[model samples]
Each structure stands twice: as C-alpha cells, then as structure tokens.
Target: MDTTTYPAPQHRTATTTAPPPRGPAATFALHLGAMAVAMLLGMLLLAPVATALADAAGWDQAAAGPEAEALVMAATMTLGMAVWMVHRGHGPRAVGEMTAAMVLPFAMGLAPYWAGLVSAADALVVGHVLMLPAMVGAMLLRRSEYTGGHAHIRARTAWGRAVEAVAHRWPTLLALGLTFDSWLRPGIPPAWTLLLLGAEYLVIGAVRREFHRDRLLAAHIAGFVLYLGLAAVAATTPATVAGPVIAAAWILHIAWDAALHRADRVTWRWYAEACAVIDLVVGVTVLLAL
Candidate 1:
C-alpha cells in the first residue's frame, strides 16, 4: 500500500581528484631545491676529500693536479648522488646514468691525454667541461626516473637516512662540479677568486628570481659586482690586507648564504649550505696559509 508508492533509494558515488600539478616556476624550484640538498651534503661529507682522492688515485703529478682533483670531484659527487638516487628507488639505472656522466668526461679527456694530444692540464680541463653537459643531461633524464615526486624508502638507521638525504641531490653534485672547476683556473686562483665564486653559490637562485622580478635580484647582482670590485682590488693589495679582505668576503658570504637559505631566496638552498661549510673549511685553511 504506502510502500508501493515510495520511490526507489538512490546510490551516490564519490569522485576522487588528483592533486593540482605544480606550476612551471614551482617545478623549477622543487628540482633546484632537490639538487641543492644533494650538493649541500655532498660538500660537507665528500668534496673536501676529493683533492686527497685525486692524489691517491695517481693524479698528484705535475700538471695533473687540477685535472686529477676535478675528476675526483666528479667521481665523488656522481657516486654519492647515484647512491642516493638508488636509495630513493631509482635502482641500477640511476647508478649507470650517473656513473656514465663521470665516465664520459674521463673517456673523452683521457683519450687525448694518452695520445699526447693534450697535456694533463688540458685534458682535465676538457674533461671538466665535458662533465658539465654530461651531468646536466643525466640529470634531465632523471626527471623520468623519479617517482612519487621521490621514492619513500624507510632507512633502518638514522645515519642511513641522513646519508640518503645528502646523497640524493644532483644540484650539489653540480656545485661540487663548480668547486672542482674553479680549481682549474690559472695560478691556483686567488683566495679572493674562490671567495667570489663561493659567493656565486647564490647566483642560480638569483637568476631564477630574475624571471619573477624578485627584488632580491638587485641585492644579488649588486653583491656580485661589489665582490668583483673588491676581488680586483685584493688582487693587488698586500697579503696582509688581502687575506683579511678575502676572509671577510668568505665569512660574510657564508652568513649571507645562511640568511638567504632561511629566507628561501636561494634556488639551491641546500647547495648553499654545503657551499657555506666548504667556504668555512677553505676560508680557515686559506687564512691559516696566509
């Protein structure tokens, strides 16, 4: 009777939506940040030992120091980063890709060296240059290998996770690349030169800011310019004055880096942190040498 007039019950289905895709700018920042983190840890844990490694690997002879050390930087950073990529679920493919980046440079440059077509210095320089493209290209390929925005693997130990976090960044590998590259400059590069370039750790983020007209651009540009002027002057100044000037530049630059990292102004803030540590190490060493 009454039930016969009642309408049939309706069933409702729920729809799930995927998260919004990150915008281009955001994507860029995320990638840079990843690389930065990788670099930061790389510098702190491995970069300093690169030189010693070069020496140990039979790269210590005359005219080979830069090349040897550069190779060490590339190998160390590549191996370190690959280990993390693997840790993050990238597997063997990542290891091969990353190692290829280092191997190609050596293959190309060393061929010339053994042929006597180039000096060790020249070959190392070629290798270093070759490495940039190889590493960057390998990193681009990594875009496909990354999953879930990064794999989630639980480390059995805190130290294992810490090591993983440090090793996972390709940016720091690039930064360490820069560190080794800087050593290739003629005459062991003045303390001021290293300081200036170390300050350049901010340049990547600075450039990224250029697109959005970030006000920090002016400060970054102005700082670089001022560094150049000061560096030039330090080139001529007595070591007594130059040492302190270089010291101030590096020490102050590290402080600036920490500040920007805090502000999230640095593209590779993680990279900057690593650079700061390296700066402190080098700055103290340079200061003591002076």
Candidate 2:
C-alpha cells in the first residue's frame, strides 16, 4: 500500500523567447507599388486633357513638343501624389533633401536645350514645364520613405566630424574680403590662379578632413580653369595683379567652408551651405568679369 501511494516528480517545461518583429518592408513596398500605379494612371488620363488644353491655347496639335508637355503634366501630378505618400513620415528635412536631389536630374534634362540638343520649344514645354513638375511631385511624395533614417545613415567618422567643425567655424569676413579683392583686381592667368588657390585649400581640407573635400577641390579647380580659359578667349584679360585677387578669393572661399563646416557640427548642412555660397560668389564674379 505504501509503495502504491508514492507520488511521481513533476517535470518543468522550458519556454522559448519569441523572435523580434520585422521592419515594415512589406508595407513600404506595397505603398511604393501603389504610387507607381497611380502615376501611370494619371499620365494616361492627363494626356488627353493636356492635348485638349493645347488645342484651346492654339498650340500646334501637330507639334510633338506640346504633346510631350501634356504628358509631363499628367506624370507630374502623379509624381506629386507619390511624393506625398513617400514623405508621409518625413518633415521639412525630407523636402530639402529631395530638392537637392532634384538639381542633378533637372540639370540633365535641361542640358538638351542648353547644349542645342533639343529645340527651345521642346525644352521649355517638355523639359522645364512638364518634366520639372513631375519630378518635383515625385520627390515630394517619396519624402516619407526617407523618414528618420537619414541621420543614422549619414553618421560620420571622427575625422569627418573634425573637418566639418573647422569648415563651420571658418572666418566669413576674411573670406569675403579675399573674394572681393580678386574680382576688383585681376592680374594672373585665371587657370594658374585657380590651381594655386585650389591646391592650397585641398591641402587644408586633406589635413582637416573637411566635409566633401573631393567635391570642394573639384569645384574650385574646374571653376578656376574654366574661368581662365574663358578669359583668355575674351580679349579682356585681367592684369597679372588680378591673378592674386582671384587666388585670394578662392582661398577665402575654402577658408569659409572650413570654418562653416566646423561651426555647424553637421557635415551635410555645412557642405550644402558652403556649396551654395561658393556658387553664388562664382556666379557674381563671372557676371562682373563678363
């Protein structure tokens, strides 16, 4: 009787940990596909409308340019919708990023007209008016896709951080002075002047590890060489004194980038601002030279 009453020992079962949830890749893909479909449908619908409008406006129905323009508008509308979808999560930062990205495509599309590869009518109607809208719309809609991931994606190394800081903190007044002086007094051949200036900055950037050093160097060198070549073609070559001025200006610009990049503590912003400022200065100088 005692042996029969003995209780058996209970065994405990081990619990396994559940796996982590996956990212929203499937949802994102679905949204992107929907956007594409919407864009196509919009294009199809808008083409007829655009044709009708052109006819009403007395634009040549026989002209391929106007028809292409119509298609661009339709596509652009769809693109705008897509942008809205993509940027659903992103804020102003996405807008700025998209705007920057659009620059290259816009330039490329316009090159046909600028380089005489396409007729003015086609360039204006299709490239600028139609294509631009679609591109912009698409950019805006896709902003959501970028979300909050850009910062993580753009994380920099120690060297990159140091260079950015220097650029941000660069002396603005000094740079401005140097730039102005170069334009006021033209002396050296533009090519040599630019090379000297660019080399000086290139060394500084390399040492500092400034943000976008390659682009900065290329821009400076290209700008200088092109300016000099153009100046040579033009009978109005600046005196040798002008060479120093141009070099000074180039140095100033590089310094400004170094300081500015360091000041902001963010390489991307610093790089963008520096580029914009440099481009402005270059444009102004070129106009003045002309």
Candidate 3:
C-alpha cells in the first residue's frame, strides 16, 4: 500500500497502543470467543446470500468456483476485520491480528468447497462469520472514544482527530476514483492502478510538507519508490500472482494509514478505513475478473 506518512517499520507489541489492557490472556480470549460466535452467525446469514449471488451471476462453479468462493470469503473477512479494527478503537496492535483472520477461510476453508468436499455454508462459517462479535465488541469498547459508550477505551487525541480528518477527505475520494476506474474499465493494468497510488502518495506528501518537513519526506520518498517498483512487478506478473500482490498491498496500505494516524503524522484518520474498504472491494473485483 502506498503511504505518504508511513511509520518507521518497527516491532509493535500487542499492548502497545491498545486501550486499557484486558491482560494478554484475557484479551486473546475475548476476541477468540466473540469471533467464534460472530462467525457462526455470519456464516448462517451470508451463505444463502452468497449462493444467490453466485447463481444470479451465472458463476461457473467448476471453472471459477475457487475464485468465487475465495472472493466471497475474502470480502466477508475483510469487511468484518476492518469493522472490528474501527470499533476496537482503531488500535494498531489489534489490526494485524484481525486482518490475519481474513485469510483463514480463503486459503484453507474455501479450497475444500471448490473440491466439492465441503459446503459453502461450512466454509464461510469457519472463515469470517465470527468477525461479527469481534467488531461489535471492539465497537462497544471504542464507543467511549466517541459518544455514549463504555469507559475502557480512551478517546482519540487531538493529533489523532486531525489525522482522521485529513484522511477522510481527498484520500477517500482518491480511493473511490481508483475503484470506479477499475470497476468501469476492468482492464486497466495493475501497473497503472499502482502508479495512481504513487501519484496519491505524492499528493499526500505535498499536503504534509506544510507541517513537519523531516518526518514526512523520508517515508513519502520510500513510498513513492516502493509503489513504482510494485507497479513494475505487477506489470510482469500473471493475474494469479498480481491479484494477491494487489490485495496484500491494499491491506498493507490500510495498516500503514492507521499507523500514520495513530502516530499523529496524519491530520485526519478516515482515509485508512476508506482505503481498506475500497481496496477490499476492488481487490476482489480484480481477482474475479481475472
């Protein structure tokens, strides 16, 4: 993911910037238990809808079944995880863990369904349905961060608010523009999509120049180079290869966006969330189209 204000890559402990600790064991248990329940629910609900969509779209089960199933699994997981991250106070530490959950069903469970060895219901149920409780819990915890809610999670700081504000503005529209292009055109190469992301970085960097000069430049420079390199890589890679790369880059982009805002390097914090969502939708669209 291209980022204008990326964090210096570093190790972050699980408790680093999270709201008041529930203790390592307790925190882990909370997400695990809640996610399990949520997954169960989401599976029951999404499975039927997915089947209907697949039928209506005239999906070739034997041919594009894996891709379709994977798409469904990944989209649901991404949405659930992103929602969880937001409600969870947009905590940096929890983002990776939650994001990781998005892949479990796509990589493992969906394969069995493609092979006719498992039902879509079973696969999706095991994939991200549990994300419902996870998001609900996180949202409730972070509610205090906003209006009426619990007191465990702290409200965002002044810098955090600013970063959110900035991110919610143009960056979001930028993602939407890219997404619309991808949807409408359907054949724009990954290189072009990524190059646009580089352009976005330039715009963000330019915006940040008005503030702290030193901290923003190095990251922006690195991000520009990285995005271009990725574009080159995507240009040569097959869709099978490029799809994952693009999806991963988008996920990483979402994470870095959060990290930046959390570090107060951003003025508004909404861009990361928007980017994550659009990336998820766009990434799946590309995967399926391919």
Candidate 4:
C-alpha cells in the first residue's frame, strides 16, 4: 500500500565513474621517490646484515665479496618492492607487501650463505630465483589496484610523447635480440654486449624531450668512463669483470633514476623506458662477456 504513494521509486542511474588517472610525471615521481627511499633503507639494514653473515660463516669478505653483492641485491629487491608499494597505494599494506617481497630474497640468498650451506655464487643464484617468487607474489597481490587505474595521456611534448610510445612498445626488444645474437655467435665478448645495452639507454634518454638533457648527458659520460675503467682492469687481470662493472652500473642506474625522477620534465613512462633499456643492455652485456 505504501508503494502506491512512493514517487515512482525515484530512479537513480548506476554511474560507472572511473578513478582519476595519474599522469606520467606523477607516476614517475611516486615510483622514483619510493625506490630512492627503499634503497636508502636497504643500505641501512642490508649492509650490516651481510657483513655479520659473512663474518659468522667464516667467508672471506674480500675474496668472496659478499658485501657488495648483498648490497646490490638488497637494493634491487628494495626497488622492486617500492614499485609494488606504489602500485598498491601508500599504507601499511604497502609496507607489509614490500617487506615480504624483500625478505624472501634475503632469506633464500643470505641465510644460506650465512649458514655455510651454500657457496656465495650458489647463494646469489638462489637469491635471484627467490626474487622471482617475491616479485610475482607482490605483483599478484596488487594486481587489482594496478588494473583499476585509469589510462592517461603520457607526455605533452612531441619528443616526450614519441619516446614514451617507443619505450612502451619496444622496451627491451633490442637488448633481447642482441643477447640472442651473442649466444648464437659465441665469439662476441660480454663487455661489448653490455656496452651496447648501456648505449641504448643513453640514446633513449638523449632522444626523449621529457628527460633532463644535462642529467642524461652526465649519466652517459659517467657510465662510459666507469665501463672503460673496468674494461682496462679486466684486460690486465682477466678475472671476473662483472663484479665491478655491475656495481658501477647499478649505482649509476639508481642515481640516474633518482635524479630523473626529481626533474620536472621527466615522465613515468620515460623512467620505465630508461630502466627497461638499462636492464636489457646490462643483461646482454653480461651474457656476452660470460
């Protein structure tokens, strides 16, 4: 009886409103800041843990060189966590997710090394394996959040837009191709491969209007000089040049990423492209050298 008096049940349209899309710059800033902070935290926490573990295991920190390796691994893992955290949105949940992702690798790698159950090299490999799970887990847990975001315009400038487009499309294709070529050929030195990989990022940064030209130029110069120095060292010793080169490259990559994130011109897509190119170059170079 009351329904007869109700004003036609006041029909309300079900509105499917989309969440506000984050611009490339905002995304870049969020990720970059998180990564930088994560690395800093890793430096504080991981360095000491690695040193203590090395000492307890009776591993010669100098010969085994676990410290630098640990730091690098920790930093990389932290960066990964930072990316996941940003995707998940800022909160305790993000922190928990990052911690879990980071801890898995540390436990798999450093724990074994600390226990003297595995050689440093074996531990490193195992640690890397653990990272796959951690990365996948973190991403899967936050998949809904990442997928829910709106698609926004990438960059305003023509060059910036072009760089973003190519980066999103091809990211690591060149590096992957070169790596395959080197594997098939078997004569190409790894250093040459890595150099090419680094060069790809340099070119990407150079071509992109979104990047800070001065910073990119500086990064290119630094990477080149460091690579050359390592090459010269390898010539005399012929020992594993990877240790030094990788260290330098990682530091350079992190620094460049941090600096680019700070600059107003750069976008998230640009940073992602830089990283993809850097990873490809580094992976190819290492494979070729080996």
The number of the candidate with the highest lDDT is 1
Assess the local accuracy of residue 156 in candidate 2 as a C-alpha lDDT between 0 and 100.
43
lDDT of 4 at 44: 49
Q: Cα deviation of 41 in candidate 1 (Å)?
A: 14
Backbone Cα, N, C clashes tallied per candidate: 4, 43, 18, 5
TM-score-based ranking: 1, 3, 4, 2
Q: Which ten residues in a row have the lowest lDDT in candidate 3?
A: 146-155
lDDT of all predictions: 0.60, 0.46, 0.55, 0.52
Best model per TM-score:
1
How far is 99's C-alpha from truth in model 3 (Å)?
A: 37
Cα RMSDs, all models = 10.9, 18.7, 16.7, 16.2
Cα miss at 89, model 1 (Å)? 4.9
lDDT of 4 by residue, 1-290 (tens): 56566456754343223453676446544544554455554454445455556667897666646645765566645643443343333344545675667656866687878898888788778866776566556645765433345233334577645544443443243234323333334332444444553455466665665346475577576776666665555445544554446434533555555454466233354455446555545545454555
lDDT of 4: 0.52
lDDT of 1 by residue, 160-244 (tens): 5566665555445445554543333312237457445645644576556532456576676667777887788678888788877
Order the numbered candidates by lDDT, best leading.
1, 3, 4, 2
- Where is model 1 poorest over a 10-residue stretch in terms of lDDT? 11-20
Candidate 3 vs candidate 4: the lDDT winner is 3
lDDT of 3 by residue, 220-266 (tens): 66877887888877778887777667765654565556666676554
